[model samples]
Target: MADLGLFGPGTVTWRVHAEPILFVGGLRSLYLQALHPRAMAGVAQNSHYKNDPWGRLVRTSIYVATAVYGTTAEAQEAGRRLRALHARMRARDPFTGEVFRIDEPDLLRWVHVAEVESFITTARQAGVPLTDAEVDTYYDEQRRVAELAGLDPATVPASAAEVAAYYESMQPELRVTRDSAEALVFLTAPPVPWKLNPAVRLGLELGGPRLLYLGVASTALGLLPTWARRLYGGFGLPIEGFTAGLSARALRTALAALPSRYVQGPIYQGAMARAAAAQT
Candidate 1:
C-alpha cells in the first residue's frame, strides 16, 4: 500500500498547499510571526536568518513541503529532528534575565497558527475557490502539522473562529520590539549572501529579482491584519487591503502559468499519484 502521508490528497491541507501563491503566504506568516516579542527575540538571538536568509527560507520551505507530502515515517523523522534541534536551543530574555526553551508550547502554537492562517488568507485573497467552511477545514487539517512541530494538537487552533480568538487573546503578549524592527528591515531586503556569483548578486541588488522580491514583500506586508500593521508602525487602510488583494491575485496568476513540475515538488507529485492509485 502506498503511504499518503499525514494528509491524503483528499484533504484540504494538501489541496491548498499545492497553490503556487503559497510562497507569498509563507512570507506573510513570517511577517505575522515577528509580531511576538519573545518570538522575535528568540529568532534574533538564535537564528542565522539575517546572514543566511535565503538558506533559511529554502530549509523552511523544504520542511513544510515534507510535512505536507512526505510519508508518515518520513514526516515523523523530520519532526523529530526539528524537535531535537529546538530542544537544544535556548533564548535569554534581555529584560527579565530569564531563559526559555525555543520549543515552548506557547511559542510553537503561535508560529503554527500564524503559518496556517496566513496560508488560508493568502489563498482566499488570491481568488482561490475556497469556501468559508473549507477554510475552517484547512485549519483543522493542519493540527497534524502542529503536532509534528512539537505542539500538542489540542493547543493549536483548529478553526477559523478559534484562530481569531487565539489572536485576540494573544494581543497582550504581542508587540514590536527593537529586534522586530530590525528583522523587518532585514527580511525586506536581507544582506546578499557572499555565495552568489557576482552577476547573481547584481541581479539581487539592482535587477529583476530585487523588484520581484519588493513586490512579494509589499504584498505580504499589506496583507497583514490591521493590528499587526499597527504593531509594525504602519496603519493599514481599506485601500491597502484592496491593493493587496489585487497584487496577490496577479502574482498567483503569473506563477500559476508555470509548468506543474516547476511549481509542485516531487513529494507533492508522488503523494498525489499515490492518492490516485489508492482510489483506483
Candidate 2:
C-alpha cells in the first residue's frame, strides 16, 4: 500500500520534482499561469494571494508533494479535498462579464499544462538527462495528477507533440491582465515570514529576500517561451531561449551537487522511508 500512490519514487515526477531545481520550475509555472486572464481573475477573486502569497506558494507545493509522495489513500484524499474546495469557488471574468467556476475543465487544463510545461522545461534544460521518449513519458504520467485536479485526463495532452499543440491553441486565450501584471510584481518580491531562523530572517529583512526572488524570477523568466517573454516586456531581458536554458542547466548542476540530506525535504524523506519499508 505504501508503494501504491499515483506516483512513487520510480516515476518521472518523483525524479524531476524531488530535485530542488523544481523551485525554479514552480516559479516558472506561476509566471506562465498569470498570463491567462480568466485564471488570474479566478485566483484574484477567490484567494488571499495578495495578502498571503507565500502561504499560497507553500500550500501549492504541499499539494504537489502529497500527490507525488503520499500513499494511495492519502493521495486520493488530497485530490478530493482540492476538488471539493474548487467546486465552491466562482469568479467573474472582468473582460467578458462571464461568470465561471474555478474548476471548469478548460481553466484546469490551462493550469495543468502550464505547470507541466514549466516542470519539464526546467528539469530537462537544467540537465536532468531525460531522453525524448522519457520527456513524453513524463507528460503522459502527469495526466494522473491532472485527473486529480478534476480534469479529464483522457482529454489532456499526453505527449510532447500534443503539449505543443495545446499551447499553440491556447495562445489566443492567453494575455497579460492588470491582475497578472500586479501578481508578477508581487511574485518577484513577495514578503517572507519572520518565522525562519533568526539569522536567516534578519538576512531576509536586509535585502536577502529581494536578491533570492530576483535570482529565481530571472531563471523562471528565462524558461518562458519567446512569445510569453514578449508579453512580460522583458522582465529578465537579454535572456533569450538559449541563455535561459543555459542558466537552468547551471542552476540544476549546482543544486544537484548538494548533499541529499540537506536538500531533500520531508516529503521526499517520507517517500524514501515508505519505499524502504515496503521493500522489507
Candidate 3:
C-alpha cells in the first residue's frame, strides 16, 4: 500500500495523509461532543444574546472556515480577518458576550483533535490502509500543535482508551446526533445564518465540495510520475479543483436571499424582537 503511491512521494500529501487523519478524528470527537455543549451553555448562561441567531452564525462560520482551510497559516490569517469582521458586527459586553473565546482552550483542543480524527476516520471509511503505529505518529504530531497552543502535551490522551474516558466525562453536556458525526455538518452547514460576503460565501459553497472531490482525485493522480504531478501543480489544476469544491453558486444564491427572508423580513424581525423582549 505504501509503495502504491496512494499519496505520492515527495509531495505534501505523503507528509500529511497519515497524521492529518488522526488530527481530524480527534477534532470531531472534541467539538461534536465536548466543546459544543459548553459553548451552548456559555451562550445561555453568560450572554445577553442567549439563543441569538447571530451567535449560532458565528460558531458555524468558524467551523466551516476551519474545515475547508485546515490549520495552515493561510487559514489562520483568514480566520483572524473573519473574526475581526464579526467583532465589528455587534456591540456587547466583552467580558461575557464573547462566548466563543471563553473556553478557547477546550475549543482549540477539540478542533485540533477533530481535524486529525476527520482525516483518519475518512480514510478508514474510504478503505485506506493504515497501521496502529501510523495512528500513534499522528497523535504525536498533534501533541506538538497542542503544546504550541499552550496546552500541556501530557494532558492530551494518548490512546483511544484515554480519549474514551475523557468523552465519558463530557457526555452529560454534549448534544449528540447522527448528523453531527465527525463534525462534518459544522463544515457543511454551520448552525449560524450564512451572512458571509457574497463572494466569500459563493467561493466556499462552490469550492468546498470541489476541493473534496479533487482531493480524492489527487490521490488517484498520485499514481502518475513526478513530472506529471509537477505539471498538475504548475498548471494549478489541483488548486483550482480545491477552490471550486468549496464555493457553490447555489449556496451563494441562498445566502444572498437570506437577509430579506430571515433577517429584515417581517417574520424574522418579529421573531427577533420577541426573542429580544423575552431576554430583557
Q: Best-fitting candidate, measured by lDDT?
A: 1
lDDT of 3 by residue, 1-280 (tens): 1121112223223344422222223333333432344443433344443235456545544443232323344334555654454344322222344425433556455555544454544444334455766655555555644544445788776554555566566544445333233233333243323666887767766777546634433332332222323333435355543442233222233434654544233322333354445455
What's the TM-score of each model vs. the native?
0.96, 0.92, 0.38
lDDT of 3 at 60: 48
Those runs of model 3 whose alpha carbons end farther than 4 Å from true positions after fitting are 1-35, 40-104, 176-280
**What TM-score number comes out for model 1?**
0.96
Q: Write one digit per residue (lDDT tens) for candidate 2, span 53-103.
A: 788888998898888887777788999999999999999997989999999
Q: By lDDT, highest first, what's the ranking?
A: 1, 2, 3
lDDT on C-alpha atoms for all candidate structures: 0.89, 0.86, 0.42
lDDT of 1: 0.89
* Candidate 1 residue runs with Cα over 4 Å from true position: none
- Provide the lowest-lDDT 10-residue window in model 3: 1-10
**Candidate 1: clashing pairs of residues:** none
Candidate 2 lands at a TM-score of 0.92
